[model samples]
Target: MNKKLQFLVLGVVLILAILFFSVKWAFRPASKSVEKEKADFTMEASALAGEFEIDEQKANVMYLDKVIQVKGIIDNISDEKTVISVTLKDPESLSGVICSFDKSSLTITQLTPGEKITVKGICTGYLLDVVLSKCALVE
Candidate 1:
């Protein structure tokens, strides 16, 4: 009611408002990624193995024409970049349904052989080597 009491109440209200807004802004959700069309690249363990063992050029051509999403393990890795050239294979270790990626995309420091993972990429028909689309770590 008096000037002093009114000022005290106003200060408290302002502090509360500031605190509420700060906390709200701090906890807001981050922007979402653009949802893409559902395209699938899949193979049976046996079939993938068969494709790989046949031959290098023959194997590469089958998978290189379209977008491929392969599930396999990190077999061989390069030292220069945290990049792993991945393969989709079966029990036999023949089919080289290949995929690849850089290290920054990984939440882990390094990926090694036998660490099973899934990858999504566009299979760019070979140019001396298999070129892949946006290669993402699929776990």
Candidate 2:
């Protein structure tokens, strides 16, 4: 092939490789999701944004994306479908973890504004809006 064609092919290959790796990496479930075997860890929302948070390193770990149990006061039940958002209370502020529920996972027949509840979901990410994985309401 001509020199130009050779460089063009190399560029194309490099671009494709980067794209493939990025998508795969981005969608790959966090380590906690696969290795945890059972997501049973529990945390209160207050600890997450306040004393529990570091914002330096403890943000995006498998524990955050793995299906784990958390007990917190029901601050807000945002959606009625596959996604329910629950925030911490009092000192933590609602900006703690904006977890998303897997609509098919669980059902809450009696979720109240100030009720304490247990939830299980993966910790997805910790941004301005922290998020958990495919969440499920614990009975």
Candidate 3:
């Protein structure tokens, strides 16, 4: 009778231990160690803008949701406290690559208008400008 009681208690403790470890493992947060993928396409900021201007649908098919590396002179940068937004040069200065840097890559400072730079980001599509998000500076 004592052996039977000990067996029952051991079984219950084993089940509870399994449940606790499984719950802990399942609820663990995802890791942030994964690096961003390499750029899928590379082009000048003005050229990217021009493609969208020529055919919005075709450009969307070619570049939307794809990582792109763009090079050009700076046209503007948003004056907000965070400063995540940047615009590259265009002929009209009205249409260009508009990049929004991710929070993880927000170490930029001392950018001035007309400074040449290269940036990589995921293209999200175009409105007045070709919009890129999750951007990071490329040396």
Candidate 4:
């Protein structure tokens, strides 16, 4: 083909190729298993909660979507049958670490409030409580 036509076709192809690869990478499934991923930070559950309460934006930058290992006393377990919500800190406290486990996880059934435990999960950020998902019992 003439140079102008060839150049136009090549540019369109390059743009299409870039878009295709970008979309593919963006939609790709995460390769790291939550259980196998290392914690980016480790701290007492109370401390983590406090950080979010004190400076949510800063805490979000540091912990949101990152794996964290937290140690605290179990405050409560939700009465829900199909989900596990493990609260860390005083049961009455609004600000606390709430680690959620999948219903299929057997470990949640074994947990009790007032027990000291260590858990690892991805920090999902704070609302009333600092929420963590995909939590696994560390101890």
> Which candidate number has the best TM-score?
4
Model 4 scores worst on lDDT over the 10 consecutive residues at 29-38
lDDT by residue for model 3 (1-139), tens: 9999999999999999999999999999843211266889989998999999899999999998898999998888885564478899765755899888755566557577789988888899999999988777885
lDDT of 2 by residue, 91-136 (tens): 4464565656555444445477777766666666666645666666
Candidate 3, superposed: residue stretches over 4 Å from native: 1-35, 81-83, 91-94
Cα lDDT computed for each candidate against the true fold: 0.56, 0.61, 0.82, 0.85
Residue pairs with colliding backbones in model 2 are: 64-123, 65-122, 65-123, 66-122, 82-103, 122-133
TM-score for each model: 0.47, 0.57, 0.70, 0.72
List runs of model 2 lying over 4 Å from the truth.
1-37, 51-53, 80-82, 91-94
- Ranking of all predicted structures according to lDDT, beginning with the best and ending with the worst: 4, 3, 2, 1
Q: Report the C-alpha lDDT of model 1 over 29-131, residue by residue, as the tens digit.
A: 7422111423356644335445544564686767655556556655555443555555544445544445555544543454567776666666665433344
Candidate 4 overall Cα lDDT vs. reference? Answer: 0.85
Counting clashing residue pairs in each candidate, in order, gives 4, 6, 0, 0
Off-target runs (Cα >4 Å) in candidate 4 are 1-33, 79-81, 91-94
- Find the 10 residues in a row with the least total lDDT in model 3: 29-38
Per-candidate RMSD, Å: 10.8, 8.7, 5.8, 5.2
